[model samples]
Target: MQLDRTRIVVRQRGVLDTLDLALHVLRVYLAPLMIAMALGALPLMLINHLLIAWMLPDADNLLDIPARYLWHMTILIFLQAPLASVFATTYLGQAVFHDRPRLTEVVREVRKVAPRILWSLVLIRGVGAAWLLLLSADRYGEFDSFVDTFLPLVLVTWAIGLRSFRPFIGEIILLEQNPLVGRDAETITVGRRSRMLHGPASGDLFLRWWTSAGTAILLTGTVYGTMLFLVGVLTNDWRQGRGMLLVAYPAAIWTVATYLTVFRFLTYLDARIRQEGWEVELRVRAEASRLVAWLVVAASVMCWTTDAFARESTDPIEAGRQALSAGPSYPWYDKQEDGLRPVHVQPARESALNRGSRWQAATEDPQRESSWGTSVLNALAQGLRWLGLIGLIALLVALTVLMARAFLMREEPGSDDQQAARGLSPLEADRIDNLPFSITQPPKDLLAEAQRCYQQGDLNQAMIYLFSYQLLALDRHDLIRLTRGKTNRQYLAELAAQPGLQRLLRPSMVAFEEVFFGKHRLTLERFEGCWQNLDTFHEDLQRLVTP
Candidate 1:
């Protein structure tokens, strides 16, 4: 019988399409998985509520209070980090495979890598706990104590944990699926040991991590401060009483602050994994279509659920009742010397108090009428105030939705033909084409021609040629004066001052200009030197000018 080589080739081709289809399915299903994850957390939230009730059984009117406040605190301690890790891992897997992973594939991958994820959580929590303990031990002046005792230790610990956890988890997830390393006990054990020590040993890593964390913290603090200022303005309650500020405002601020901080750290980890190929193992395990669906669904459900709960809990009637209770009250009735007084009428003329009542009414009624103007003004002012508030809220919602839609759309990688066919406008195409080191032909051809001219012992010709090339390379506005026969040194100086160009081309451009403008003589030696410099300049320029 003849060996059937074509059968083997056909089988391989079959698997390739199957994998692509699987990835497409995974991408489509990620949203639903995300929804399921949020829904899954609801039981845990209920349990937390039960625990809170058990702990404080005597507290009255508990149902009226929002459940989220209590559950959020509990979830943060037990569930938030793990959930975030899962989501981050899923994102990495999707990114690495360049397709959506199936939900079952993601879950299985997550299960296999769960130990690693748990280990990361342990490392983070351990470091955080230790830092908190050290902070608590310090009994110096308040702000100084926080800075000296807490900040340094926390910063160091966080930097170390982040650097280690990101690469380690990524490695575990990516490497877990190899046929050679498949979920086998011995391979996993070896992998775990390797992952435990992947963090940066150098000082530079710490500095980078610290700078990223510090910037995030500063931004979060600034946002919180701004929000508090806005709240103070809206409430018209400028006094910062510790009870109200600490219990309600500060807790809310801190929660949001921590969420943003963790989000930033996750983004940093993503960048590191993308740059370093740390997510290869996870990608191998990821089933594309399911994973995508899971992410999209989970995120969407969580957002919707949270929004719905917020809307339901914000009762306008309750708000109005609270506002009324907070204001002064008036008596329903009053008594006089003769009998029970009718608040709207004077006493009968037969009574001794009639004359006194008449005098009192005459004197005080005008004053009361004058005072009524203040009440009318106050009511009108309150009405206008609510109108402005309603308008402001509508405006904010519109802006938020616009921004969310702008940022949240999925962007898939496209083919070159597809991109070209989009046929962008000239200015837009120029911007895209000019993106640095993009491997298109214009800059490369220009540089090659300049190098050839320089090698032929025509220094003046080379300078003019390269200068003209530079003029054509720049945006139209930058080349306007050059085209008009103006050798504007100031314009060149301005270009030189641009930080990116300065970093890439300053040395070569400076040398070239000196030789071109009679500041330096051209000899065989100088020509060779300028040629070498210009070659390097061309290389840099090619990097800058290529699409």
Candidate 2:
């Protein structure tokens, strides 16, 4: 595997950038990732069905099973998430280096570390114990506040805290192959490595965890909502059937969980890049390897050149014939009736060239078919390695272009605060303390303020203003019921019936994410695009209000 030539660009990335990039990655490796996740999750799903889903069979209410199972399943999946990610994490570890690890290889790698995983994730992290807890609650639907509620609540809270601060333990054990126990004081054990990796960046990891959790929740809801819509449309029924409870619901959860596995891996890479200068180390090691490869090639060429010279000096005729023919030389001896006879004698120094041409000789000789097959296999392997390198380069280039666009625009610190302070009603100030636009402002005034911000070259603030205007205009037209804590995607999903409004808000939301969450400087091109969309949106709002 090549150290420098990775499938993704090795660099420090903000939480949003990493999250965005994971979508592209999911598309590329969807099949394998899905398979890996399913392989890990299926057994656990079966076990939970028997333990939790079956426990509430005698509950009085018909909806008890669905509610009880989903509630228990949510906590179980959260606790078992790291365990379920073992296969995917191992596969991604090899994939990052552009190596296409086979299924058996991934399984074997996980199997080798099964003991450690069980110890650290299952026993110590209480993954198995969580299952046993649910099992111990014998009457699952009884809803004992402590056994059914407080216990699982405490488990989930602990999981959130542990996973948020140290989310990449699966990667550490599976990818880094850190020993569970240190052999000596100099050696780093898994515990020590976790601290070393997570200690300095604890705060950032916690923030990223909240961001990822929010995104995951949104994605899960979107997917589950889509599933419900499809079921209703296809069957003309909206009831929560057994299939929905047993399959669709869990599928949605696992699907989002699978995607987050990729997100988590990217975060791990980002953390390493920030804390360890891992990209620099990869580059240095890659350069050293390239230098070695070049030196070997040069030495081989010199040896071939000197050997040719030696042959020419000793036997000019044979040397000329061999150079012109560019084929393997015959053996010095031939089998004859009398015995081995000298057929075409050549100097011993020229024999190395003959040895090097053994592959060609084997292919020409039908009797040595196995040797020929071996040669073909070796060539194919080399070709695959080269293809991996090419893919690595291409992926790097694509990710670089994407990151360039995502990170180009950054907001000036306190720009929003300064803008918000200028014109404020006390009520508006209290509502949106840092937002540059009043929630109560007319859409036209918000648009004008955004224009002034752009005119003043505060592109980021301008984009925020445009985004704010979008929400204001939508709220005024009664397109959406705007509320705090609702995401832009949620708003877009709400406007799904209005293609015109959805079209305008979609790209604006992307720009909004880059400016607000990504903290990128809004470029002129992006600002203009948002400006156009908002202008069109404002016109649409006027038509709606006028009618």
Candidate 3:
């Protein structure tokens, strides 16, 4: 329950760092994570396949039906990814605290908040609405534009937009366990917490989501492609088959989704660290807890030993009277010597001082003597108790001061400063500073810059400028978005729906990747070839734009 005792260090991390850390977390908890993910996703996958299986022809030779089933299931998985991640999210919450919760424990924890998950993710967010709609259409391939295409498009767009702004709903619902609708103003409902956590950083969240989406798409493709290549080599079957569609493709997608689930959890932590000074709060709370524990132990020991140091008198009469008067109070000697010293038995001296404390004791007390060591010991114990109290107060003050400083300086080393340090332009820096590569310049200037680079025979620079111009142009037309997080492969995937554009743009993208990423030498002929492809793509883009 100690926040400061997390497996990972509590601190702010950049988007890419979060991604990398997610990978690390996944590896560390791979077994439990896989078990949790499988438990949640397998049933949903089966349900999805069953719902759409009827749309496929009953004929055993229907590859197209199975392929369609595959794509539909892929989309279904994307929609339901957050829902499936519920188990992983719960397990990772415990994993963050270095606890390897059993699958039963994860399920139990999830069961406690099942209604919230249902209401927030399934009912309110509509994660499962598409499937529910699909359930009504008893036939497949009867593609009504509204029912099959437009409705799904609208649903997807709405979901994406909603999720882009508020992707941590699963974490909030399952992990935080906030009430759906708080009855009082002081209570923070799930909705309010989501707004409070995500509101200030909306732009940041979008960029992070944008970047993560691009990366996830690329990863899914890479995984799927690898699986295809392996299948082809092993069985000489390059065509999409039942196994490829139903098994390989979904596996690839789910693999990436599981990793992304971990990534989202980390981002949640980072957001808390940023907006709420969560790391500071954890440390302060932990220190305060320890202080209180120490105080309890010290008080317990003092109380436990109190009876052993009861005050005594040489006169039994006086002692009896003192004990009688001491009724409900602590031992009399507790007030002296800090109540920690053992009895010092003075040898029976014919001293009248110890005989009586009434009229005779007043005059006899001055005649009695005490050892210097005893006086020094008593003073030291009393001084130590006072010092202990003062130290506890000082510790509390220091913790308060530290928390204040952390809050005040949380925004230090501002984003602009980080961008500047990385040598990125304002525009490029603002997009995502943690991206491995800076995005292309705006389309208006990049084409001319590419031409200039070509003229100067700086082929590498030319290729980069050319590629940037291409991406920026696509982005301008809303055909595909340009993000620093995206790579050549991701862009190609984005343009998959438009075969014409993709075909024309393919050569240039490949050439750019070769000369830029593959570190291949760019010959004059190759540069000219890339240019030719760009011209064709530009012409097509203009036509598309005009139309």
Write the number of the candidate with greater TM-score, choosing between 2 and 3: 2
After superposing all C-alphas onto the true structure, candidate 2 shows an RMSD in angstroms of: 23.3
Compared with the true structure, all predictions reach lDDT values of 0.44, 0.77, 0.77
The digit string of per-residue lDDT tens for model 2 on 412-457 reads: 5664565566664444444353332234333335678888989999
Kindly state the number of residue pairs that clash in model 2: 4
Model 3's C-alpha root-mean-square deviation from the true structure amounts to 27.2
Tens-digit lDDT string for candidate 3 (150-259) = 66677778778878999899999888999999895336688767776677678899999989999999999999999989988998877766667667888999999999
Tens digit of per-residue lDDT, candidate 1, span 193-309: 333223322233344445544654565457656765776798776544433332443344333333332333334444344333334423433445456779999999999978877
Give the top-scoring candidate (lDDT): 2
Instruction: State model 1's lDDT.
Output: 0.44
RMSD of each: 27.9, 23.3, 27.2
**Candidate 2 versus the native: TM-score?**
0.55
lDDT of 2: 0.77
Q: After superposition, how far is residue 138 of candidate 1 from its true place, in Å?
A: 17
